[model samples]
Target: MSNYKFILSGGGTGGHIYPAIAIANELKHRFPDAEFLFVGAEDRMEMEKVPQAGYKIEGLWISGIQRKLTLKNLMFPFKLISSIWKAKKIIKSFKPDVAIGTGGYASGPLLKAAAGKGISCVLQEQNSFPGITNKWLAKEVRKIFVAYDNLERFFPADKIEKTGNPVRQDLLEIADKKEAGIKFFNLDENRKTLFVMGGSLGARRINQLVEKELNFFKENNVQLIWQCGKLYYEEYKKYESDLVKVNAFINDMKLAYAAADIIISRAGAISVSELAIVGKPTIFIPSPNVSEDHQTKNAMAVVNKDAAVLLRENELDEKFENEFLTLWNSEEKREMLGSNFKKLALPNATKDIVDAIEKLLKKAA
Candidate 1:
């Protein structure tokens, strides 16, 4: 087999970056000699993250249009033009067999340029409500791989494939690591463990909720494994103790998931996808400060199925305690939620997405 060159673009946040890395990792596994190049917005997280994942990446001068009118808005057109030009040059020089986008500012121009060059393109939409970038690229791309059902409302029905978001592979074997997880965190196995994650940077409101409820958790004999995120680690680090383990980030998420009996998290698309596989009873506090309020919609997909609970940021003060107590007090309720959530897990999502990409490449050949 000939060595295939692939271009993957996604950035701005972990949600988009991680999925792109997951897909790239899977493709590298299948095509060991394949050359991979990642394109991401200059100064964005992916520029840093992609390299850490051990892939070569080039940065594009790109950013999203700000919702508010500002000097940044005036620069949007310039950035778009520059990014597309750079994307075309990259495509021409690299001569990739396929271009895959996980959806971010850089992807809009990169995939558009790749498709214009007659290179096959694939998009992975991690949310039920597709982003503007993915929606725009839908017409040109060869296939749209999605994590949610009924996305035909956004993309062409013929092009859509319901493949769940790619998550860390280590999370797949969490059940077998329970003892190791408990020991790693040095937590009491006899007590229930509540895991709190706010995303890569962390959620301020979620951290506050945990801070406010620390005494309640201790009184109830519950142990906490809190990922306070980088931003708030200094403020929250003082609370770390035997019953509560606070971290800026959990490097081994598999161990964290294994230790968690219950989880409180923000409903970012990738987080929800990983949680579904973790199969823990979870309460989602979706961030309101997102595009199209997509986080709420992401949470509702599982909540509507009775597979998880949704606690809006605004509702946290009024509803968090009662909602949390309801779950904490009942093992039966927790089991039901965990079981239903597990049913939604797409364990082979990475493989399935690669399968679709291979078919497209075969057709091209």
Candidate 2:
């Protein structure tokens, strides 16, 4: 196993990239000497993120096709050809025992090339709605790891593994860190804390909603830990004070989860997974900008279970106050939502997905 090589590819967003890194980290832990390489889109966040995570990475000239016609769409063919060629070169030289994809533009070419060279491939689909890349690679991959059930509708039923998405390992112990969390955020333990977050880039609508409701929060004596995201931090930072802490990003997310009494967030798949483990009452304002309205679908899964509240971006203004007040004022409702959400958590998701990969490695051996 020491001599074995593994290639992992995913990018474009932290949702895709973090899962790939988590899987890679778990594999590295198990086979301490195993070599790992990452493949990501050249100009995408993963090119910087993967290296920051202490893994060597190669970049491919790849981009997704736009829904509407554009000049970049015209460059897609050349990029695809170049990416596939580079992917083939990487696979041939690295000779990985298995290639794993977490669903992004870069993964398509890399996994396809690995499969073409008789290498076993695995894919991790983070959303209930599979992305185009994972759906395209499903037919040839050895195993398809997914966070949600019913993905068989998109991929071959036999190859699908219902392993939940991997989250930051530190979040698993958030329950024990409440005191530290309060200290870390410098928030009053006596006051209810509302944690607000968009994704890394921030949500324009969510930020606006928070801004509009700042007075409401103050009136109710609720402390706010707002993660406005890097994109909108400057505009929102003026609201920060003793009771209102604003951040461009929350690096100590585990503590943020621990301190949060209620969460107002976008319902990306990874965010949903983390919140399930956090077991706090939550209101999901799903982003409508996503493909196929998947973020809404992701939030609906928990909403349908009565484990969380889903307030669509369009409905936020009309409905957010009622929803937030109801949850904040009722201890029983909050407790029930938290309990139901905890039931949905897969604490061993990273381990389970890695176990699936190990099984494939064993079969190959």
Most accurate candidate by lDDT: 1
RMSD of each predicted structure: 1.0, 1.1
The digit string of per-residue lDDT tens for model 1 on 219-310 reads 88989999999999999999989999999998999999998999999999999999999999999999999999999999999998999999
Q: Give each model's clash number.
A: 0, 0
**Candidate 2 lDDT tens digits, 50-117:** 99999999999999999999999999999999999999999999999999999899999999999999
Q: How far is candidate 1 from the true structure (C-alpha RMSD, Å)?
A: 1.0
Identify the runs in model 1 with alpha carbons over 4 angstroms from their true place: none
Report lDDT (Cα) of residue 326, candidate 2: 96
Q: For model 1, state the Cα shift of residue 212 in Å.
A: 1.0
Per-candidate TM-score against the hidden true structure: 0.98, 0.98
